[model samples]
Target chain A: MSKLASMLSTIMILFPGVAMATPDIIRQQLPQSVPHYWKWGSLFVNLQVNYFKVFFLVALLAIIIIEFLHFVIIGPKKFRESGKKIRVYNLFVRIVHWTAALSFTLLVPTGLIIVFSKFFGGDGFVRAMRSLHFIGAILFAISVVPLFFMWVLHMLPEEGDIRWFMVGGGYLTKKEVETGAGRFNPGQKIWFWIATVFGTLLFLTGFLMYLRKPNFVIPFVKYQIDALRLAAITHNLIAVIVLIMFLVHLYMSLFAVKGSLKSMITGYKDEEELKYMHSSFYEKIKHKLNE
Target chain B: MYKYSRMKFYCDENRCINCHGCEVACQVGNDLPVDIARRKVITFNEGIEGKEYSLSISCMHCTDAPCAQVCPVQCFYIREDGIVLHDKDKCIGCGYCLYACPFGAPQFPKDGAFGTRGVMDKCTMCAGGPAPTFSEKEKRLYGQNRIAEGKVPLCAAMCSTNALIVGDAEHVSQIIRERRMAHGHGVLDETPYGWDIAYPNE
Candidate 1:
């Protein structure tokens, strides 16, 4: 009888589903460490931390170095604003621009530190950077609303943009590229589009990772892990593009073009430069470009 | 040459009295923040007679540690003896480890503006981190290094019922097996949760 009992227990261990079925008392407390979805999500995290970070960081450094050398090689343009100032950017436009710019300025460094802090900092350092990044992400997401609404209509890509692209939008080649685009040039339109699309993506992904749970999974998405993983990968990829475009925009507005910074600051552009730079748009808004 | 024995910890639920002495001892020993509980005794069916059982949980310091694998900073390291240790200096507190750990061993103190995770804190298995052995910095960051002193961990040592056991994996299991034989039959989580994931031995 004892030998039969021992044999029965061994068989019971084999078909645990049939034999040692979950007792109610222990059901809720079984240590569920890793399920399939968690492991799948982990793959995305692996890619994000390893591939995206290394690749984008390299690209960021390369862009800064190349742009700096360009400045050294070809000293920025000396477009004298013809002394006839016209109101190109209204107060609303200026406000949105500064808000986006300031928020971006804070976001970039803090975001990078959050990613790379493990390489350099301790608990205290990471804590500080994480806090800063959270604030910056909120400001960034909020600023995008005004920025998109303000510039979306004006940034529609016109027919001339194709020609502008061929000539490198006057950014690549030293010679002038005649775009004759509307209020926003084709190059500017491209920047605006990239920023709008990828900027929104960054915000979404940033928040998903920030929330740290299942509160914001994509609707109708059966696979929560897939959606979250996609978010993680997409955010990293778009962040690289956003960083590049932001640098280019900053350089052009601040140094590459002489009157560009003044126009944004004062909400006015030199009438002569405006006409020469945005000839077609200049035609549409000339009358509106008040003295 | 054989390195140190594979370090491991086992908590017998049958012997546990739900005293929470392990949790309190760890917090006091580590000087961890109130919000951070390096060790927690999770009690199931608290008031229900005969169904009451508590599990003292913390980092298992797995052989194939997921935290070490997933850490972007590569902060976590596994000693030859299979004790997992992480460098605080290299931890970004991104909470990747928290998500990856099967035991939920990695913990983050809530600190950032959006309740953002602070640096990860977990059981060091009584072994200090990368800091010089027995140094004050290591003591402050990783709690006591009793293993280096040839002593049992405070959690197990302070267990009034001797429910928590910590030492070499082989020796600990042998002891448990002997007890099983002596007692005929009792509840046992035969495979330490996540043991295969940590130390595949494959």
Candidate 2:
């Protein structure tokens, strides 16, 4: 389509959001060259790259925290008590875990290549890096899709989990803390919700930024750009906050309260530890095991 | 030691015809894309009786540019000759410079289908791209940098009325002051000449 026609349509679509339709006003206020490109086209792509970087950064932190809790915080204590028989992650969880983990790691560096390409110019290596980055971002986005379902079954909060949150989940102080959190604590549930909401926003906003050809419409470009900027800010902020939370979660699971990592790692907790830490669930599972 | 001073752009309002000649001069000389102009004409009509004066606005290349101060990465740098330049590598595309510049100079390319061009492009005073000397990459990203080749900007040189003059700061300032003194307290002194004074409010 002709540039002017496309520009008119694009402006018409975004007209409701901003006062852009009055050509007289636009002519007066805008520089003659201002609309040479679409209203907010460049800003849109920038927001996309930034948002993904934020998402990957947060996911990486979450992985690190979950692993740390297993090895350092809860692992040693579990080993001392049960002598290394518990497994925190099952075989299926491990497969999904790694697929998502690898995808997340690949997304950041790849996405950065495209975002930073202007500085590097169109040099061969830079172009190659950006191409790879987009591929990695797609992989990461695809891998995250299944996590919602996996989490749907595991991350729901019960009344007991709410109580766990009320007492600060016994994370703040070391002694006199009782363990009553179920399959997932209220804290983990909250992170799951964040991952779902912000993660979806990041993916959809990111896809619009690509705006690849025949599939994407021109009029939505401005909207895509504005929404993308907001998504980027939200995505990055969540990533940073989530990273810190994951670190704390890791420490608690592996060593802080003891025997927590053993449950995920070996798929079992000492009978006594289970009785104290997850009495209600333990009783139910134990009764089933006996039957 | 390198000397530090404010960079400025001066326009002789009396000479401008509001023809937008300067705008075309800048775009063609710099090979800017279809819709971008490094220079522009702004017109104000008042006092009836068919009297209106047009002012051209672009990068003032200020001595204390707001773009430089607010940039988070400190990408902007002022040359010893008082020309402002920035490293595209360090730029984060935050658009803070747009808010800070008294005379809006920074220009960003439109992001199209071939992925977004994250780098910012602007008038380099006809000195070409970020790279040294004229090369294909620089030409593609920025227009020619003729000043580096010991040439005056095409826009200033092409001004039919000599309204735009690009040169050492003292010479241009002297020329404007002389024109104002010779013309006396008429439209030339007030219109495009003193337009910068009236610029902040509008």
Candidate 3:
């Protein structure tokens, strides 16, 4: 028996494939060039398991602190309720805007809860939050298409955009300066693109994640990549960018510029706000006011 | 002093015939849904003469389980004997555990609207759950609790070739070592297939 076993072992060693076939076959099947992003020691796992929660928490705190300090020191861009209102947003526009806003309100908190789930403790509450996250995704999906087409023309970069950026859209200082902005200020335009473009990417990646096993092949690649892992990495990265911009949008609408929130609600902007913040836009629209 | 023992499962690749008996046994014994497989048999190098081998895989119940780490609800818990388990009630079915798990051990039933996932399900090693051991609720939620009754897991028990073994880590390793020696193999340079990722410290 010992002699037979030794002979068998010698034969196995000489013909490795006979004894251990899987390793060589696996190597041949998978592309050697592309790194496996889903496994440990990769950037995707490290970010998801270690740093995502910290990054989100720090970003939230920084935005809140900075905005709070700005509010205290420079104060809001106060404008008198000039009794007369300009119809800046139509009813359809207001409806679409609020629908997107509602989605954000749901998505942001629930997404944060998911990221900080360890602290919150898993249960029905967090589970419900996850369900609500999906609901928010649905609402956003409904609103994004209309929201994009309705405002894309207005959101295009104008000659005055450079000047608006240079003067910081008259946001830094108390003194009212000529911002040379359009109907949608350069700041609002930036927020618009971020919300629409990055928001779409978020939805697509999120849909991929929702599928659980998105194993389709890429157009030019010979080897299949772990699509679920790639989606997760991309989703988290885009989420961070979108979160920061959303906070800025929230601050600008609710606090940074007084009466800005009213326009979305009532489909009208105060004449005083229109003149100072959107000076060039006011210059063009004032003729109609005079008429 | 009582010796510390961590329960683990070891699959002898050379011995596995890929008959899928383990998978069928687990499914039938647990009354699992058709879609949810607690254990599976994977055959590598299929149809290749003298180069084909098979492996039976499920949750390894790692010392530091990634599913436990990533679960938003802190639902997963490791028992004193190192059997990884989770509370079904606490699981929200967010699928984070699936992403974190290297073996794709976590399984979700599409029990929600628009195909949204319900709570997670996976191999329990037949140890049941936090529910009262051997009770109807425990059996319904987490299948059989053979471990509690001092019996081997159904899959391992049903393996015809004795390819799948489950027991204390030390005992499992001893069996593996004995098998290697009997086969005239020398000391292996590497650990078992997923041991490096699953039990880094060990």
Best by DockQ: 3
Local distance difference test scores for all models: 0.71, 0.55, 0.80
Alpha-carbon RMSD of each model: 11.3, 8.8, 10.4
In model 1, the runs with Cα more than 4 Å from the true position are: A1-33, A69-80, A118-127, A208-235, A286-291, B1-4, B11-34, B40-57, B69-77, B89-92, B112-115, B128-141, B154-164, B173-191
Candidate 2 per-residue lDDT over residues A1-291, each given as its tens digit:
656765564445333233232222222443332332233333433444345445555566666766665464434332235442333467666566556556555654544454344445534455355455556556656767777777687777676775676666655443334456776677777866765666566566554433211122324333222333344445445555544554555556645656565455456556556554554556556656555
For candidate 3, write residues A1-291 as lDDT tens digits.
755654464345333234321121112323221234234324555677687877898889999999999999998998877888899889999999999999999998899998887677777778778879989999999999999999999999998888889998899999978788988888889889999999998998787666544333344334323455566777888888889989989999999998889878988888888888898899998989988
Q: Which candidate is the best by lDDT?
A: 3
| CA error at residue B112 for candidate 2, angstroms | 10
- Give lDDT tens digits, candidate 3, residues B109-184: 7665455777899999999999998899999999999998999999999999999999988899888888888888
Cα lDDT tens digits, model 1, A142-221, are 78888999888888878766666665556665555455666777868878888778888788777655544332225754
The candidate 1 chain A region of ten consecutive residues with least summed lDDT is A21-30
DockQ (Cα-based) for each candidate: 0.19, 0.12, 0.21
Which TM-score does chain B of candidate 3 obtain? 0.95
- Tell how far residue B64 is off in model 2, in angstroms: 4.5
Worst 10 residues of 3 chain A by lDDT: A20-29
What order do you get sorting by lDDT, best first? 3, 1, 2
**Least lDDT summed over 10 consecutive residues: which range in candidate 2 chain B?**
B193-202
